[model samples]
Target chain A: EPEVTQTPSHQVTQMGQEVILRCVPISNHLYFYWYRQILGQKVEFLVSFYNNEISEKSEIFDDQFSVERPDGSNFTLKIRSTKLEDSAMYFCASSLRAGEGDTQYFGPGTRLTVL
Target chain B: GQQVMQIPQYQHVQEGEDFTTYCNSSTTLSNIQWYKQRPGGHPVFLIQLVKSGEVKKQKRLTFQFGEAKKNSSLHITATQTTDVGTYFCAAHAGKSTFGDGTTLTVKP
Candidate 1:
């Protein structure tokens, strides 16, 4: 089965530094999403994208966060300035459809660590 | 609130024992999906329930969605070590909102 793939499985950056997390979603999937899971916490939705545009975002997705589909296959999330609280596992997901019942497949996740 | 709450944050069961996790939401949902994440692994989709009072079974696992569409449950029969993981229930509308999840440990 095709799976979402993310680069830099683990990222370590200094506070206030910019960082980009990259992911390549399954070949034919259309709906893409970014989610973060704090250690021992629930998965929180950051943003959802369709047709290379953001569909919705959560409060956690503030000024520092931005997502883009720079190419046909690459989806990226950038944080302008990292903070200690921003350290978490970032997962990229995609589904064939954005309907309520469509299943979203998640990537292995990129663990971001800020010091 | 749009929160999806799960109960008994943790569960421990001996091999061959049964385990179940409950998920509830404050508002009615369009659909519910269950995913399992093993230690250091990503969330893997298990099943999706859409209709009210719908029940679906996958081998030894049974999933049910409430009539009101605000609650759901996952039941595993005769648990095995392979069943050790955190089970999360996510609500589906225009986006995915996941529950805190119930972590299950199966001891042989």
Candidate 2:
């Protein structure tokens, strides 16, 4: 089955450095989302994108965070400057529809480690 | 944003024993989804329940959506060592919110 794919399974960056997490969602999916999980914490939503724009975002998705569909298949989350708290497993998900009724497929996730 | 909660933060069971996890949402959910993440791995979608009071099963697993559509449960029959992992119930409103998750440890 077609699945979401992310690049750089793991990343290590210095505090205050910039990092970009990339994802390739399923071809036919229309809604894309970004979520992250701190070690030993619940997965938290970051943002949602549709029609090439952000539909909603969580408080954690502050000014430091940005997302883009630079190309047809590439969905990316950029952190302007990493903080120690930024270290977490970032996941990308996509679904064919916009409702909870639709199943969202997730990528394996990119483990971000900021020191 | 919505809030989803899961019960029994952790569970320990012997092989051949049964396991169950509960999921509740503070707000009415349009739908609920279950996912399993093995230790050191990522979350994988297991099932989705939409209709009120709907029930679905997969092999040794059974899932139910509450009649009020505010809660759900996942039941596993005859657990195995391979069943050890964290199970999460994610409810999607406009945005998706995942519960803390129930970690299941099946001792062999």
Candidate 3:
């Protein structure tokens, strides 16, 4: 089965530094998503992308956060400046169709640790 | 954004016992999906329930979506130590909103 792949399984960054989390979603999937799971917390949606643009974003996805499909297979999330609270497991997901109904396949996740 | 709440934040069971988790939403949901994340692992899609009152089973696991489309549940029969993980119910309206998952631990 083709699964989403992420780079740098674990990332350690300093506070106020920039970091980019990269993901390679399934080739045929159209909708892409980013979610965060703070330690011992529920998975929270950050943003959704389709047609090479952002469809929706959450409050947590403030100005500091940005996502881009710079290339056909690469989906990247960039944090302008990391905060201590930014530390968490970030997962990238994709589905063949609309995310509302289609099943989403999640990546192994990139654990971001900001100190 | 839509929100869903899950019951029994944590569950611990013996190897042969059963386990269940409930997910409830305040408003009608378009669809619901279940995922399991093992310790230190990421969420893996388990199943998706779209129709009202729909029931689907995968081997020993049973999943149900309420008739009103406002709630869902996942039941495991004869749990084993390998069943240890957190189960999450995601209510997707325009986007997916995951409930606080129920962490399960099965002791052999």
Candidate 4:
């Protein structure tokens, strides 16, 4: 089965450095999303994208975060400057349909570590 | 107070024993999805329940949607070591929100 894949499975960056997390969703999928999980915490939604634009975002997705579908298959999340609290497992997910019942497939996740 | 809450955050069952997790949401849901994430792994979709009081079974696992469409449960019969993981119940509307998850540990 086709699955969402993310690059740089593990990323380490300085506290004030910018970082980009990349994802290649299933070729035919239309909607994409970014979620993060602090160690020992529930996964929190960051943002959702469709038609190369953001559909919704949570408070955690503040000024520092931005998402783009720079190419047909590549969806990237950029954080302008990392903080200690930014260290978490960032996951990329996608679904064929942009509806409530559609199943969203998640990537293995990129573990971001801020130093 | 819209949220999905799961009970008994952790469960430990001996091999061949049964296990079940409950999920309740404050608001009605268009659908409910169950996912399993093994330790140090990503969430894998298990199944989705859309209709009120709907029940679906996958192998030894069974999922049920509540009559009010605000609750759900996942039951595993004769658990195996492979069943050890954190099971999350994600409620769906225009946006999807997941419960804190129930961690299951199966002992051999």
Candidate 5:
């Protein structure tokens, strides 16, 4: 089955540096999302994108965070300045549709570690 | 903000014993989804329940959505070592909100 894939399985950056996490969602899926999980915390939603724009975002997705579909298959999340708290497992997910019952497939996740 | 709470954060079961995890959402959900993530792995979709009081089973695992759409449960019958993982219940109203997940450890 086709699955979402992310690049740089692990990322280590210095605090205050900019970093970009890339994801290639399923080719046909329309809705894309980004989530993060602190070491032992629940998965938290960061933002959702559709129709080439952000549909929704959480408080965690502040000015430092931005997402773009730079290309047909590439979905990238950029953090202007990395903070220690930004160190977490960042996951990308996509679904054919957006609804209550739709299943969202998750990628392997990129572990971000800020020094 | 919505919250999905899962109970018994950790469970240890014998190889042949059964295991269960409960999830409750602060607000009513339109649907609920279950996912399993093995240690050091990504989350894998297991099942989705949409209708009220709906029940679905996949081989050894059974899932249920509460009639009120605010709670759900996942039950595994005769769990094996392969069942060792963290099970998360995600509630969907407009966006997805995942629970803290219940980690299962099965001893052989």
Candidate 6:
């Protein structure tokens, strides 16, 4: 089964530095999403992307966050400046469609640790 | 903002015991999905429920969606040690929102 894959399984960066988390969603999937899990917290949605644009985003996805489909298979999330609170396990997910019942497959996740 | 709440943050069961987790959404959902995550592993899709009062079963596991589409439950019969993991119920309104999840620890 084809699955979503993310690069840099673990990322460590300075508090004020910029960081990019990369994901390669399933080749045929159309909609992509980013979610984060703070240590023991519930998974939180960050943003959704389709057609090279953001469909929706949460308050946590503020000015510091941006997502892009720089290439056909690459979906990248960039944080302009990392904060301590931003440290979490970031997961990239994709589904063949954006319908309510569509099943979204998640990647292994990239653990971001900001110092 | 929509919220999905799951009861019993943790569950411990001996091998061959049964287990169940309940999930309630603050608002009506168009659909609900269940995922399981093992220790240090990613969330894996288990099942999806679309219609109200829908029920689906997989092997020894069963899932149900409430008539109001605001609640759901996952039940496992005679669960084994392999059933050890965290189960999360995610609701879809416009976007998917996940519950806090119930962590199951099965002792063999």
Candidate 4 chain B: minimum summed lDDT over ten consecutive residues — where? B89-98
For the candidates in turn, chain A alone yields TM-scores of: 0.98, 0.98, 0.99, 0.98, 0.98, 0.98
Candidate 2 vs candidate 3, TM-score winner: 3
> Which has the better DockQ: candidate 1, or candidate 4?
1
Determine which window of 10 residues in candidate 1 chain A has minimal summed lDDT: A94-103
Expressed as tens digits, the lDDT of each residue in B1-108 for candidate 4 is 469999879999999999999999999988999999999999999999999999999999999999999999999999999999999999656566889999999899
Overlapping backbone residue pairs in candidate 3 total 0
TM-score of each: 0.98, 0.97, 0.98, 0.98, 0.98, 0.98
The digit string of per-residue lDDT tens for model 5 on B1-108 reads: 898999989999999999999999888888899999999888899999989999999999999999998999999999999999999999755667899999999999
lDDT per prediction?
0.94, 0.93, 0.94, 0.92, 0.93, 0.93
User: In DockQ terms, which candidate is top?
Assistant: 3
Q: Model 2 residue A85 lDDT? A: 95
Model 1 chain B weakest lDDT span, ten residues long: B91-100
lDDT of 1 by residue, A1-115 (tens): 8999999999999999999999999999999999999999989999999997999898999999999999999999999999999999999999999937898999999999999
Per-candidate RMSD, Å: 0.8, 1.0, 0.8, 0.9, 0.9, 0.9
Question: For model 2, which pairs clash?
Answer: none
lDDT of 6 by residue, B1-108 (tens): 798899889999999999999999888888899999998889999999999999999999999999999999999999899999999999755567899999999999
Candidate 6 chain B: minimum summed lDDT over ten consecutive residues — where? B90-99
DockQ of 6: 0.75
Q: Please give, for residues A11-115, the per-residue lDDT of candidate 5 as tens digits.
A: 999999999999999999999999999998888989989999998888899999999999999999999999999999999999999845788999999999999
Residue by residue across A1-115, what tens digits does model 6's lDDT show?
8989998999999999999999999999999999999998888989888889988888889999999999898999999999999999999999899836899999999999999
* Ranked candidates, highest DockQ first: 3, 1, 2, 5, 6, 4
Error of 6 at A108 (Å): 0.6
Give candidate 1 regions above 4 Å deviation. none
Cα lDDT tens digits, model 3, B8-51, are 99999999999999999989988899999999999999999999
Model 2 misplaced stretches (Cα beyond 4 Å):
none
